[model samples]
Structure formats: C-alpha cells, structure tokens
Target: MRPAFVAALALCLAALPAQAQQRFKSSAGDLVVETVAEGLQNPWGLAFLPDGRMLVTERAGRLRLVSSDGKLSAAIANTPNVTGRGQGGLLDVALDPDFAGNRLIYLSFAEPRAGGNGTSVARGKLNQADTALEQVAVIFRQMPTINSNMHFGSRLVFDRTGALFVTTGDRYGQRDEAQNPANHIGKVIRIRPDGSVPADNPNKPGWQPEIWSIGHRNVQGAALHPQSGQLWTAEHGARGGDEINTPKAGLNYGWPVITYGVDYSGLKIGEGTAKAGMEQPLFYWDPSIAPSGAAFYTGERWPGWKNSLFVGGLAGQMLVRLSTQGEAVTGEERLLDGLGERIRDVRQGPDGYLYLLSDDAKGRVLRVRPAP
Candidate 1:
C-alpha cells in the first residue's frame, strides 16, 4: 500500500474503541473483547432474565435492564433505600431458579439502618408491565448495624439445593466482629428462599443460626465450583494479600487473625498468615488485585476454557482466568490488561460467551468471544 494510504488506515484504527482492536490469547484460543453497552454508573452486579435481557445493579442504588440488543432501560422502580456509602450500595443481583414462573429476583445491598448501615438481602417479583418490583421484602439483615461504610461484603449465589448464600463484610471498623459468630459481620450466611435458617446448618449455640462460615474480611466475589459443587469466594485484603477461599460449613477463614496481607499503613496483620484451626486460602495474591465478581466457565463456546474460574480485578484492572484441575487451580491468565479498566463483574452468558462489567462513572458491559 502507498505511504499515504497506510497513514490514513492507522488513523482510522486509532479512532476505534480500545476493545474493538485489542486482542488477547488464552490457553483456549485468540480472543476479542467488545463493549456491548455503556454509560453505566459504577455498575457492580449482573443477572440475566429468561428472555436474554440483563438486570444490572449500580453501586449508587439503581437497578436497570439492558435488552439483548444493548438498549438500556430506565431504572426499575420499588428498590429499597440504600446507604450508597463507601464501597456500599446496591451490590449483587440474582434471579430465582424458578424465575420464569415466580418472577422473583434477589438483591444484595448496603441497607440504611437506624444505627448506621449493614448488608441486607431483599426479594421481589418483577412486574415487567409496570417496570417496578412487586411484594418487595427485606428477607435478611446483618446484625448490629454499624456506622462504617467500607467493607460491605455483598454477593449473592444460589446453590443447587435451593439455598441462597449471602456474603457480608467486617464493616471496616468492626474487623474483630468477624471472629464473633454472634454477629453477622464479615461472614457468609446461608438461608432458605424465604429467609429461614436451614435445619442442617452447623450452628454454634450462641452464634447466628444463618451463618455458614466466618472470619472473612470483605468477600465480594463468589460462585459455585462447576464440578465439585463447592462454594468459592474472593476477598480483599488490607494492603496486599488478596485471597480466594473455598468456604465451608462452620469453617473459619482467618481474616484479621491470619492474613497474608498487612494493614494499609504497612503494619502486621493477624499472627502472620496462618493459625492452628483457621482455613487457608485455595489461592492468594500479594500486592492485592482487589478482586470482585467471579464465575465458573462451563460454556461450550470456549471449549478449552471449560471449567475455568474467571475473576474480575478492580485495582489490577484485568480479567483473571484460573485454569482448574478438579478443585485446584492449575494455572492463571490475565486478560484485558491493556484496556486499563477496572473489571467489576464476570459472567458466562447463556449464549456461551463471557461477559464483564467495567467499574467507572461511564462503566460498560463487555462481551468476549473467539476472534475471527
């Protein structure tokens, strides 16, 4: 091609969106990332409707719908009042397993309370025709609401047994409460669809009956392992030492007592990363990626990526792909680092492709597929 023609082509390519031209290669194959929708304000969670539309939660306490064709809808009405404080707000969304018939959806948010704010879960039916929630009810609320805004560990996932698992944080100022089973701070709680505690829960006498696990800092990412059916979570550390744990019934995850990280001021944290009875992480990162949403890839669209675990990194600004062998992570790959956007959530679409939400004032939903 002539030099003048080549110069014009370069300018055209430069004008295209970053995702349009940026490509990455994974163990599966060459991949391309493209923005599906934009203009979202610090979007956090995403769930799909039966008809292929998406329900997304904004950190500022708005829930909106995005059609399959990428059209964004106005905020759905009847959402509860949220604190929207630091690191808190409307966080995660999940549809009922029987959503088609029940029209039920669950939301996890930092709820405004009398003393202050706390993580709470609510369920409501989607009145599609009216664009509002019907029968909205707060199903569960974290105990002893505190004034702090940071560390509202809120993520929602449903197991095959129909129990809902909700993650809560240490409320920043209440890290010590993570070890206190009586309170809901910094814990994972499993409850029934109607907000009742399960009979088989491994509950301590004085502890909250709904708690499944404890000793977590701020768990924001959670999903079920596709094959093992175990619950896995990713939590943020103080300054460094981000961790991924497979939380189990009545297990202690060792947050303030045993951490791989230190205080933000570079002080030691909890007895130097190990203790006699505390559970260790399946994987961890030093220098902290600040991981958020997670999903296990079981789709056929990327054959080689099957069974992989995908985690979004906020501070690291990338998509983390962990190749798994059974219950253990065998390898890791970081995708979309060149895009330089804080990835907030990752999910596998029903169409078998990977989807992500960017965290920013002008956040966007992104789709990933095999390059042509």
Candidate 2:
C-alpha cells in the first residue's frame, strides 16, 4: 500500500473502536440474534432523536431516553395518566417530520376516563440534557370511551405533505364499531400537526373527517411505502386472520363482515373471507403472528432488504421480513425466535441498522446488523 493510503487507513481505524463492528450483527442466515441492551420494562414503541438517541415508551406509562452507549435516562415526567391493564397503556412514539429542526416528539397512550378509556395522541418538545419533555399538549383524543382495556391500536405516520395519520382499535368484542362510520374506533384517522381535521379529507361536512379509513379491527403496525408513498397497515384479526391491508380513502376493511379467523370462543367471525363492499387484505397470516411496528428498510446496511417491510411479532415472538414486489406481499422470513421474547417494535436506526424492542417486564432494546 502507498504510504499516504496506509496513513489514512490507520486514522480511520483509530477513530472507530474494534467493538463498533460487533455492536450489531446478524448470524445464522439472520435467524439468530444477540442482545444489545436489556432490562427494559414492557417496551412498546421507540422513536429516534435527531442527535441519535432513542426515545422509548413503556406500557406502564413511562418514557425513557436511551443513549447510544446503552445508558437509559430516568423516566420522563409529566406523562399522561394511562389505564395500564390488559393490552392498554402508553403506546407508540413518533418524531415530528421536522424533528431535525424542531426537536418535537409525539406519544400515544390509553387515557383513563370515567366510564372507560380512550386512546390519545400528544406532542411535546424533548429536552435531551435533562431527558424530559416540555410544552406537552394533547393533540387528538378518540371519540366515545369504551369499557374494554384491550385493542388500543395507536401508531403514527406522516404523509408527504406532513399530515399525521393515527390508527385506533375496536375495543375488544365491539365488532360492530369497527365497521361504523359514525364512530372513530377501529379506524385510521388523518389530522394536521396541531390535531385539526384536514379540509380535503373525505366526508368533510357532517362526518368526523379525521377518519381516513374504517372497518379495521386492531391495526398495530403502519408504514408508508418508501417508493410509492402509499400507506399500509398490519392488523390483528381473530384466531387465524392477521392481515396486512393497503388502506384506501373512504373504504371499509371488512373486520366483522369478512375475516380468515374465527372468534376467540371458537365461533364464526363475520360472514366470510370475501364480501362485497369491503376491501380485501393484501396478505394475511393463518395462525396469526400479531404484527406490530412496521418499517420499510431503506437503510444502506440491509442491502438485500431494501424496500422490504419488517414487522415485529408479539404472538409469534419473532421478527418478520416480507419481500415486496410493487404492492404485492410475498416471501416471509422469521428471525430471532430463539431469543425467546415477543418483539413489539422494530425500526431501522439512524445509523442504518435495525433496532428491536422486546415486550415484557424484562424487555430489551436490541440491534441487528450484518454478521462478521
């Protein structure tokens, strides 16, 4: 090697530690996963800060800031009171589209009410120094509280024009509301950054125009296609019908009318799999993986997984990677089963590697990278 070239290589090697390459790794054809960070508490959602820190939400109504060096900050103060029972509590976290310039973050939680509880979305500015939230405000609240504590599907995604999309659940056993136009439950809703209904939304006159799509049962994972910018969601159906649906404006997603799964009590669910006036799922799971926290792999680290969708599986306790061919969902790969934990959230980190949040009292934040 040339002297100058050798000198430059030495400088670069000295800058990065030897363990940096091992910080994340994938082995055994991406089937085996190693731990990155542990001791989390039922981690539900994670958002990346502009400075490369991670903002993680716990199911017990706590928000924690995790550093790149694996240090977790104290629980964030001033989180909204949540009804942490069954499948409810503090949920998804999303950064503002202008987060690089604004330092703003949003959180979704199950807000307790008199008769029942409702899903709520709030936005606040994050103070990295103190690891706290400031100027927090409740932006949107779901309509008509329900008695059940299950099925609060709260995920946030922003459109190209900066409009926010929020998903809600049917509140367990409320099959009829999932298809109801009057109720916001079991629907994908769109709103402005400040939580006002967009004027261009469908049914702007008498209807609750925030609703973008309806008839969804309990959608937990949603992501925008990196190429086409279209929205997609993975929802939990009954026994066998976990579905990945392409959401369309003003369309019903046939929760109670058509499903591949039966009821939890071994009863029939809806009419059948194909029904008129209802949209069909792009793909579905027979035994049900309970998908959550989806993302398109546009990162450079995963060259083979470019444009593919990665979903966390709670019921299957694995990471699912789906190959996409221009709106067609095909080819599934399950990873990290031997890790023995339910993956609740998956996102590609700003460093171009994948990050996963295990859902349990002894949860963990793990990183995945190409194996050495």
- For every model shown, what is its TM-score relative to the native structure? 0.93, 0.91
Residue range 171-280, candidate 2, lDDT tens digits: 88687888777878899999998999887778744457788988899989999999999998989988989999889778889888899999888999778889888998
What is the per-residue lDDT of model 1 for residues 25-69, given as tens digits with 9 covering 90 to 100?
766778888877888999999997755678999999899998656
Clashing pairs in 2: none
Q: Give the TM-score of candidate 2.
A: 0.91
Candidate 2 RMSD to the real structure: 4.7
True lDDT of residue 310, candidate 2:
91
lDDT of 2 at 269: 78
Question: Top lDDT: which candidate number?
Answer: 1
